[model samples]
Structure formats: C-alpha cells, structure tokens
Target: MPGAVEESNRRLLRARDAMDRRFAEPLDVPTLARIAHVSEAHFIRTFRAAFGETPHRYLQRRRVERAMFLLRCTERSVTEICMDVGFSSLGTFSRVFRDVVGEPPSAHRRRGPLPPVPTCFAMAWARPATDRAVPEKRPERLRP
Candidate 1:
C-alpha cells in the first residue's frame, strides 16, 4: 500500500477501534466517518477494504460476541443480556445470534457454551456465518 492509503487506513482503524469500544450504544456511520475524518462513502469503503465488512455488521457481530461471552460467564437473563450487549431488538438479536453463532441464544445458554470461533479465526468464521454449522476454529496467519 502507498503511504497515503496506509495513513487513511490507520485513521479508519482508529474509528473502528473507537466504535468497538463504544458498541454497547447507538453508533451511526456519519459519526464514525467524522471520527475518521473522512466522508461516509469513503469511510465505508475504506472500512470494508481494511476490515472486510460493513460497519453496522461489524458492530452487530461484536455485540453478539460480547453477549455470548456474558451468557456463558454470567447469570443474566436473555432480555437483560440483549439490551446489555446493545441489541435493541430481541428478535433481531436472536436471528443474528442463530445466524452467526449457530444456535438460538436460549439454546446456547442452556448448553452453557458460547461461539467457539477464537479471535485467531474470527475473520474467517464470523459475520456471514451459518446457524447450524460449527465453524472450524482454525488460526489465521498472525499479523502485527
């Protein structure tokens, strides 16, 4: 990558990191773009190029990941966990959970398990995932 593009990516990553930290609340593309000092289209494009997914999708996935952890590590109710992890709609939460984690939240809770894909393989397995298949937890080549 060229120097300018690398710098822009650094800015986008800054925005992404900020949103990740604050994902348990509302996040808008405009706000994220502003944080990155880029226009919305540019931000979205850069984000996808740099991270391989849309911002909204990434946020939802992160929320679901957090919810899975909390579900296994805590005794929180489904509804409580839904809102606590920033999912505004329980219906949507359940669907996304099933879509990405391969089970309904209740079933996952009952099973006393969470999404098994480790961060090492998070990129290959997260986001556009299945509701029934247990994703192979393969580690990706390490990055700096």
Candidate 2:
C-alpha cells in the first residue's frame, strides 16, 4: 500500500482507539474528524471504508459490547446498565440490544452462565454477532 493510504489508516485507527476507550462519552463526527484531521464527510466515508461500519454504528456496537459484559457479570438492573453504558433512553438501549444480539437484554442475560475460561475468550465468545439487515422499527413504550 502507498504511504499516504497507510498513514490515513493509522490516523483512522487512532480515532477508533479513542472511540473504543471513550465509548461512554458523546463522540460526534466533528470530534472524530478533528481527531483524524479530516473533513467530517471524509472522515465518515473513510472510516466506513476502512472499518466496514460507520463511526456512529461502531460506537454503538462498542457500547453494546460493554453492556453485554455488564449484563452477564454484574447484578445491575437493565436500566442501570443501559444508562451506565451511555444510552440515555432505555427504549433505545433495548431496541439496539435486541437488534444486535438477536434477543432482548433480559433474555440474553438469562441464557447461561459465563463459561469457565479466560475473560478475553469469554468476552469474544459472548459478543453479539453483527446482523447487516436494517433494524426493525418498533413502537416505543414509556418506561419509568
């Protein structure tokens, strides 16, 4: 690969790493673009090309991944987990969780105990498989 392309990828990776570390924070395209030293539109396009997902979607996935760990390992309530994982609304969290994990958080939490293995291996094994289909739109019910 050319040096320019390689350097661009490195910059993208740095932004991605920031997203991974600060997934709980409100990370917008402009912030990420600044981190990558690119225009917002270019950052979105190049990030999608390099990562196979948009930066927003990538951040959502990271948040959901952390929520999965909290759901399985901690006795925290689902709403608490949702808020702790950076989702402001429980409805959105449940919807995104169901879309990404193929089940509601409660169902997922009850599925099984974590296997007796290394934490890294267990996390990898438990991470939700990505579904490329358009997430189904559902009516949101009010929650207290």
For residues 1-144, what per-residue lDDT tens digits would candidate 1 score against the true structure?
A: 569978897898899898779989888889999999999989988787888777876777788878877777689898999999887889878987887787898887786643566754743543344233323324498999
Best by lDDT: 2
Q: Worst ten-residue run, lDDT, model 2?
A: 130-139
Residue by residue across 91-137, what tens digits does model 2's lDDT show?
Answer: 99998888888789999889666878999999898877655442533
Misplaced by over 4 Å in model 2 are 134-144
Residue pairs with colliding backbones in model 2 are none
Candidate 1 has an lDDT of 0.77
So what's the TM-score on candidate 1?
Answer: 0.76
The whole-model lDDT of each prediction reads: 0.77, 0.87
